[model samples]
Target: MDRRHCLVTGANRGLGLEFVRQLLARRHHVVATCRHPGKATALNTLAGEYPGRLHVLPLDVAEPRSHAELARELALVTDGEKLDLLVNNAGVLRGSERFGHVQPADLEASFRTNAMGPFLLVQTLASQIADGGTVANISSEVGSIALRQEFRTPSYAIGKAAQNMATSLLAQALESRRIKVVALHPGWVQTDMGGEQAALTAQESVAGLLQVIDHLDEDDSGGFLDWQGQTLPW
Candidate 1:
C-alpha cells in the first residue's frame, strides 16, 4: 500500500495521542494537531523521536478560521496531496454541574467543540482526503439514545448526538466519492473524561476501534459502530 498519511486532531493526550502513537508504530505519516503545540511537550518530543514520521500542527477545533488556515498551510506544503484518514477526535465533555443544574453556556460550548468543531474540521479537510479515504468521528456511547441507561451527561449527550448526525450526513455527501464515514464509540474509557469508575482503558478502547476501522467498507459508511464492532442504533 502507499504510505499512509493521517491527520489526528486533539492529539496532545488521551485517546488521540494513543492513536498517533499506534499509527506511527505502523510507520504511517501522522499530522498531530492540538490547540497549543507549545504545551504539548509529549507530542513534540515524540515527533522528534520519530523525525519524518510525525508532524505536529497547531489546531484549535473551536476556532473555525483555524481550520481553513490549516488547509491552506497543508496545501502549500504538500501541493494538494490527499490525506488518507482524518480522526475527528477533539471534543469536550463538561459534566453538567449537578443534576438539572446544567449551565447553558457550558452546554453551548460543549456543542461547539463536540459537534461544530468536528463538522467544520471535516468540511475544511474534505478536499484534502482523497476520494477513497476514511473519516472517524470519536463519539461516545452516552450519545446513544437507543442505549441510554440513565446516563446523566446532558451536554455531552446532546453534542455527541449531533456529532453522530454529522457522521451520517458526511457519509451521504462523500458516498459518491467512495469515502467511508462513520462514528466510533470509544467506549467508557479510563481517560480524563471517562473518570475513575470507567471500565475500559484507553488502550483497550482504541484497540477495539482500530479493529472496527480495519473492517470498514463503503457499505459500512454512515453506520454508528461501537469499539467492539457492534452496530449501534441511532
Candidate 2:
C-alpha cells in the first residue's frame, strides 16, 4: 500500500474527511489539509489514531501563498518530491443566495474557491507529484450544460463549468506523462454545502467516489464522471 501518498484539500469535515477515512482504511497514507486545522479536533483525532498514516496540514485552497507552503511541506515529507493522488476538494458557497439575489461579490467568491482555487492548486503542485500521478477535481453535475436548469447558484454553476474545462485541458497537456485528470461529481449528499434535503449521505457519496478512483485508468482520464460512474455531459 506504499504506492504513493495522497493529499486531499478541504479535509476538515464532510465528504473530504470521509474520503481521508476511507483511503486510510485501504492502507493509504493521506495528507488531509484544511484552512483551520487548529480547531479540527476530528482530524486531529484521526491523525493521532493513524499515526504517520494520516497527516493534517493547515491549508486554504483559496489562498495562493498556501500552495507554496504546501509544496515545501511535501518536499519535506517525500525527501524531494512525491505525492500520488491530489484531490482538489476545497470549495465554498456564499450563504446559498438565489439566482436573482446572486451578488457579484458572492459570484467572485464562488468562482475563486470552486474554479480558480483548484486551477491554482494544480499549477503549483504539479511538480510535487510524481509522473503518472492522478488529480481529481471534485466538481458537480450542476455544471452540466446538457442537464441545465435555472439553478440558484449561478456562480457555482459557472465555476464548475470552468473547472470541467480545466480538467480537459490539463488531461491532454499531461497525457504524455500519464498524469490522469478527472472532474468528479459526488452525488447529492448531506453536508453543510449539500444541505439536509440532499439525497445521499456523505458516507455513501464518498464511498462511491473512492470506488471510482480505485477503478481509474489512463483511458478514463479527462472524463467528467459522477460518483455512480455515469459519464456527464459538457
Candidate 3:
C-alpha cells in the first residue's frame, strides 16, 4: 500500500492513541490532535519514537476556532498534500445523567463535541482531504435507537444519534469527491471511558476498527458498523 497521511482527534489516550500507534506502525504519516498537546505526555513520547512520522498538535473539538487553527497547522504539516484518513475520535459522555436530572450543560457539551464538532471539522478540512479519502467517526452502539434497551446515558445516546445523522449527511456532501464517511462503534472498549470491565481492549478494538476501515468500499460509505465490521442498525 502507498504511504498515506492521516489525522486523528483526541489522540492523547485510549482508542485515539491506539489509532495513532497502529497507523504509525503501518508507516503512515500521522497528525494527532488533543486539547492540550503539551500535557499529552504519551503522544509527545510517541512523537519522539516515530520522529517525523508523527506530529502532535492541539485541538479542542468542541471549539470551532481550534478547528480553524488546526487547519492552518495541518497545511504546514502536510505541505500541500491531502490526507487519506481523518478519525473523529474526540467525544464526551456524561455518565452521571439520570432522566430528570440530565443537565443542560451535559447535553450541550455532548452535542458540540460528539455531533457538531465532527461535522464542522470535516467541513473545515474537506479541501485538505484527498479524493476518495475516508472519514471515520467514532460512535457507540448505545447511540442506536433501534437497539436501545434502557434509558441509560441519555446525553451520550442523543449526541451520538445526531452524530450518526451528521455522518450520513457528510457522506452525501462529499460523495462527488468519493470521500467515504462512516460512523463506527468501537465496541465495549476497555478504555477510561469504557471502564476496565469492558469487552475489548483499546488495542483489540482499534486493530479491528482499522481492518474495517481498510476494507471499506464505495458502497460502505454512510453506513453504521461495529469494530468487527458487522453492520449495525442506525
Candidate 4:
C-alpha cells in the first residue's frame, strides 16, 4: 500500500488510538487529535516512537472553533498536502437514562458531540481532504432506527440517527469530488465507552474496520456498514 496522509479525531485512546497505531505501523503519516494533547500520554509517546510520521494536536470535536483551529494546525503539519483518510472517531454516550428522566442537557450534549461534531468537522476540513479521499464516521448500531426493538439510550440513539443523515448528506455534497463518506459501526468493543465485557476488543474491532476501509469504493459512499464490512440498514 502507498503511504497515505491520515487524520483521526479523539485519538487519545480506544479505537481512535488503535487506528493511529495501526496506521503508523503501515507507515502512513498520521495527525491524531484529542481534547488535550498535553494529557494524552499514550499518543505523545507514540509520536516519539514514530517521529515525523505522527503528530498529536488538540481538538474538541464538539466545538466548531476547535475544528477551525485543527484545520489550521493540520495545514501546517501536512504542509498543505491533502489528507487521504479522515476518521471521525470522537463520540459521547450517556448511560442509565430512564425514558422520562432523560435530561435535556444530556440530549443536547450527545447531539453536539456525536452527531453535529463529525458533520461540521468534515465541513471545516473538506478543502484539506484529497479529492478521492475517504471519510469514516464512527457510528453505532444503537443508532439504527430500523434495528431498534426497545427503548434504550434515547439521547445516544437520536444523535446517531441524525449522524446517519449527516453522513448521507455529506456523501452527496462530496460526490462531485469523488470523496467516499460512510458511517461505520465498530461493534461492541471493549473500551472505556464499551465496557470490559463488550463483545470485541479494540484491536480486533479496529483491524476489521481498517480492512473494511481499505476495500471501500466510490459505490460504498453514504452506506452504513459494520466493522466486518456488512451493510447496515439506516
Count of clashes, each model? 0, 0, 0, 0
Give the alpha carbon lDDT tens digit for every residue of 114-193 in model 1.
98999888888898998889999999877888888875888899999999998999999999999999999988888898
lDDT of 2 by residue, 28-58 (tens): 8789999999998999999999997788887
**Stretches of candidate 2 above 4 Å error?**
1-3
lDDT tens digits, residues 20-48, model 3? 99999999999999999999999999999
lDDT scores of the candidates, listed in order = 0.88, 0.87, 0.96, 0.96
Q: Given candidate 1, what's the lDDT at residue 124?
A: 87
Better of 2 and 4 by TM-score: 4
Candidate 3 TM-score over all chains jointly: 0.99
What residue runs in model 3 are displaced by over 4 Å at the alpha carbon? none
Model 4 vs. true fold: TM: 0.99
lDDT of 4: 0.96
Lowest-sum lDDT 10-residue window in model 2: 93-102
Q: Which candidate, 2 or 3, has the higher lDDT?
A: 3
Could you give candidate 4's per-residue lDDT for residues 1-234 as a string of tens digits?
Answer: 899999999999999999999999999999999999999999999999998899999999999999999999999999889999999999898999998799999999999999999999999999999999999999999999999999999999999999999999999999999999999999999999999999999999999999999999999999999999999998
Angstrom error of the Cα, residue 129, model 3: value is 0.2
